[model samples]
Target: MFERFNLSEETLKALRKKGYRKPTPVQEKAVPLLLEGRDLVGQAQTGTGKTAAFGLPAVELVDPSRGEVQVLVLVPTRELAIQVAKEVGELGRERGVKVLALYGGKPVAGQVELLRRLRPQVVVGTPGRIRDLLERGVLDLSKVRFFVLDEADRMLDMGFIDDIEFIHSKTPPRKQTALFSATLPEEIRPVIKRFLRPDHGEVRIEPEKPTAEKVSQTVYRVREEELFDTFLRKLEETPFRKAIVFTQTKVEADELARRLRRAGFRAEAIHGDHSQTRRERVLRDFRRGRIDLLVATDVAARGLDISGVDAVFNYKLPLDAESYVHRIGRTGRAGREGVALSFSSDREDDRLQRVRKVAGDAFRFVNLSDRPVESGGRRPSSGGRFKKTFGGRKGKGTFGRRRSFGNPSGGG
Candidate 1:
């Protein structure tokens, strides 16, 4: 089936044995161009198996015989760094390839020790740790051939553009580069222009239709002062045992969790301020379906690939419109529909309008206050906390999306 795509014998065999019968649209379109060593900008929605699409090419291009680091992938979050590193390790398992993940919050000494001994063929890490290693001269980009900035938009959003540019300057100008993002904001265009090669190609995979049919979405138009009371009432109405509530500030995350638990709800807050171990413990209990609700800030919830989120609450709308899509996307997954409720006051109505514009046909809104006397109440499904993807494809849960540029520009 993949013959038309021209994968090598070893790769073809592995795909067949691994039960990868057909390539997703992303792999079909992107694999060919990247294999030719052309710099590429891939814009696609989440859950499209993009990791394999970009990962296979990197694996194929690596010279396992050479002990030096040949490829580098930069992500925005430590969670993403570990997730991507796990995928790279699985795909390169047969070849005995060494793939290492380096990020903050972990022991830096351990990562440095691993780097010195193995000198892995592929390195996956967040920008901060990679930048630190580069400054210490522990990481050498002089011999690097393949480079990818996965989640490029988020990297720029986190104010890592200067660091990315610095990292790019250290590499050979002629190296192969690929950038992946769900959406390429105007600000990010400059990053692409300054760093990539001359003849770059564009690949866009359109978003799949959203399935919220199994879920009943509702919006509450409460007064600013009554937000907390409305949240409690909705919790009583819905049968969701576990939920994720998004807030604007780290203080709000802490404050909301404290308030919820004080009101007799089992809840915890996760933010960047907490130690890495604390975050892990909180996330573990939530995933095990032990914790009833998780309160988080934007940075805490971004790129969280968790599944079976019964519902996602926009306790406060994020400033960015794209972030609204990301917040709701936490719940709906696989072929099963999930609930996404938002709390918008009179002052925040404009942002809600923006969300309606971008979401298009996949979303519908209802006034929660207009309920009938005999309301058909909703309850969480008895389904497992984890739901597999459509076509039974695993590890395809994406948190964001990027639209494509038809006539791409390379000018900085």
Candidate 2:
């Protein structure tokens, strides 16, 4: 399959070794342009093999003989940084191209020490850590030739535009740039406008959205102070209700999960605060049905391509209308109808109205909080005999081997 695309023989061998025969749509389109040195923006939904689309080109262009950093890749989270760096490193191993993933919450001393010796040719890191390293003179970006801002829109969504500029400032102007995003916001448009050469390419690969199909939208009204209590009572009487409660804040995620556990609901909290190892465990348990509720902030929710989410509860209002859509999308996946409930406490009436306005003609909403709560809720049925699929949630509970990336970039 790669023969038709004219990839370099060295890259072809690596792909074959990994059993990557045919390329995903994003890879097919983005690879040719990227290898040609066409600065571009790749628009594709998650899980469409996005990392490989850009990773191969980056690896091929790098010069391992000169150990100065040649490629700078920025991701939103440490997990993602590690994931990208690993993928890049794996493909570049034979060529002696080293990759390092630098992010917060991990030991900085080790990374500094590694750079002093190996001085990886490729550096993958989140915006904050990258900025920290640059400011502290630990990372050298002057010779960097390739720069990629992965999940650019998500960075904008998390308000990382300023940090991106700071990192970009450290790189030489002659560097080639590529950006990958699911959607373009006004904030991201300017990065292309200001940084990318005039005539940089754009490749949009649309992926199928099975998760959108299984979601059933609903609404509930309650008093502000009693809202959390009301959610606890609702699930008590509900059946077959394995759920993911989406909260806007990490604090709210921890607090709600704590309350749910206290109420006798088997629950766990997953968010950016948890280490990659902990997040992997949480995803495993949730998928295994050992945990009934998995409370998560938005960062915890994205990039989890698993299905069979029985319910997605918007325990609090989404910070924006689009996030609301992405939150409930976790359920109602894989062509199965799933429940999505949003709480509309009196204080959040205006926010609910905004949701309604944004959700017009999207999904029908039903009022359920008005119904009398059953004296006691029924136990939710388990997910049935575990089917061999993508395994478990990354931070929740999982079922099979979590994908492993041996390289520092974790690109694949």
Candidate 3:
């Protein structure tokens, strides 16, 4: 499919080197239109190669001879900025097109200095940092011919619309723009209208497919008090090469990681409070299999693209239906079969119903004790035994004897 696109010789060579033999569905549709200098709005889910879908064509059009920022890619998070820049840089390496990732956590002076020295042809960054540089008169967008909003919906969720609009105002009016989002909410329509031309091309790829079909989803009806024990039992019994456990808050993520480590699992936690350096290190270890498990909050794990994750465990239920989809999406990538196990306690029945309504019977309910144990020990499936060990009410129970379920100190 890549052969069909009118990609330049340099990009073609890069694609070949990267072993990109065929185009993903989104890439197949968006690459051709983007290469034709047409603006686009791509509606596709994460892990669908949305980065390369737009990055390839953006690189193919760069005039490497001129040392000007011709392309600007806006992402929601710094991690995504680095990830996108890495992929785009690799594709544009033969052309010697400079690529820079600019984000807030790092020093402003450093990015400003680099912008002055390199005048990078492609800049991938968060909306806030991009706007800051634009106001400081350090980053120039007058020569920018291509603009991309990667994870547009996430940017909206983060309340970066004003910053995106301000940064977009700095770019030339004739430049081509592309907004790629997993799910397009009604709120984004105004922003799209303001930034993109009315005649922009639209590419919708499986917009209704909220979750990957390859993933086998299941729900474990474990009580709140036995959440960790059930999770631990599943971990001990199941065969997971790599797994990600999602929590609702940073505190929960940290507490869960600590618990997992105490249980002798190679675990690490990432959240909004962690420094960029630490987060990068943790993600690197997770990707290289140095860490067997990663516990993270929703914001920390958004746009994360690591393959070979065999399972995903919901340490705690997510607040929204969309978040549940994104959390489970961490696994079942690259045409591989994966498992997603969510724990639905009685207290979370309302949220569970909401998820069921939105997800539409995607998950099969299963009891943890019913699953076959990979090891020799008997599976911990008896609710009576669980109640005896935990010593609490059936419907409302706490992990620790002195604390309640809602107490943050207990970390339940």
Candidate 4:
């Protein structure tokens, strides 16, 4: 916890102003080692205060008087670049450290001007844009002392491996490096071997399937035609203060939000194509309770830290079970109980079963679409049975196994 650590008064005051009472588990373990100059490979899920675990120490290392870039944080998406940079800036505000965020989809000329004028002490950016700036010789990394790769797994999934390697290649080998991810697949081995130091500190937390534990997860079986009606009835019946509806694609997200608005529901759609300014406005409205429901695609919802989200609706099942976990995790955070309702048709039975296998006893199966079943006129066994599709016993709740790399940087 921050109470135990001996940080400077300015940093401590900044944390207190932000109402940070104690350190998260990740911060407790990684802060001391990071301050000691040991490289780290931290494995933890989103919303676990990872930014502060690395950000505070990074801030402490900054020498504002040096007037050059000392810390570089590479993230997967523009949204994340903005989010991480904002948090870092807040933590270092009292120390007079200038933090800048660089990402694609914005004006590169403006970024070049900022770099030339501010000479930011810290830079957080997406790999592609950062690479572009490096190629153009507009941003300098020759003096960077701390390098961080946040969301390493997501960067690889988004096909930024080559760009990430190129960016790392430009930094001096002696710079402290850290790689943090929700999951570490075997494919990351070569990158870890090539980048992290041999004796880097490793702090891994067992990933928690919070959807089952913190949220009441329920699955409703309905025909494709009845899906919308079922979702509408569920929304009408539940007192959801704020909710997020997940769709498979941007078009679907936009269309659904339109339908919801036409039906007298306050909703907005967010996707990759939305301009950054519009996205920020939508998020601000959602946070301020001006908008009650937000419909979003999976990619658009990444790196969002929204509070007071009472429920989550999976309008369309995700393509993968891992994505299901991430979607439902949107709610049920910060010690609050949340509700997750999923509408599944027979065609989506396979996907639902896959989610169940990973979700275990946390998921409760129910058939709410049948009229007779809802009216208590039909027996629970008589309605469409999602369990029948399983055809056999459950798999004892074992889904994808979580791997532990004690010291991945220890190369052969």
Best by lDDT: 4
True-structure lDDT of candidate 1: 0.73
TM-score of 3: 0.67
Q: Which of candidates 1 and 2 is the stronger one according to TM-score?
A: 1
Off by over 4 Å in 2: 157-159, 211-234, 240-242, 247-300, 304-309, 315-329, 332-412
Of 2 and 3, the candidate ranking higher by lDDT: 3
* Model 1 stretches with alpha carbons more than 4 Å out: 93-97, 105-110, 156-163, 197-199, 222-229, 248-266, 271-275, 288-290, 297-302, 316-326, 332-337, 347-364, 368-412
lDDT of candidate 1 over 1-412, digit per residue (tens): 6767666676677677678888899888898899988899998655687888888888888888888888899997788888998888777766666789989987888888999998899999888889888999888888889999998976775667878888888888778999998777798788888868768999987654334575545555556677788766566555454579999888899999998888777789987667667888999998886677899876567667687776788886666666676677777666555777777664565665565555544444433332221112332132422121222111122211111112323311
**Model 4 misplaced regions, further than 4 Å:** 207-215, 220-300, 305-325, 332-339, 342-362, 366-412
Top model number, TM-score: 1
Instruction: Please tell me which model should have the higher lDDT, number 1 or number 4.
Output: 4
What is the alpha-carbon RMSD of candidate 1 to the true structure?
A: 12.4
Q: Which ten residues in a row have the lowest lDDT in candidate 3?
A: 386-395
Per-model TM values vs. the true structure: 0.74, 0.68, 0.67, 0.66
- Write down the worst ten-residue block by lDDT for model 2: 384-393
Clashing pairs in 4: none
Q: What order do candidates take by lDDT, descending? A: 4, 3, 2, 1
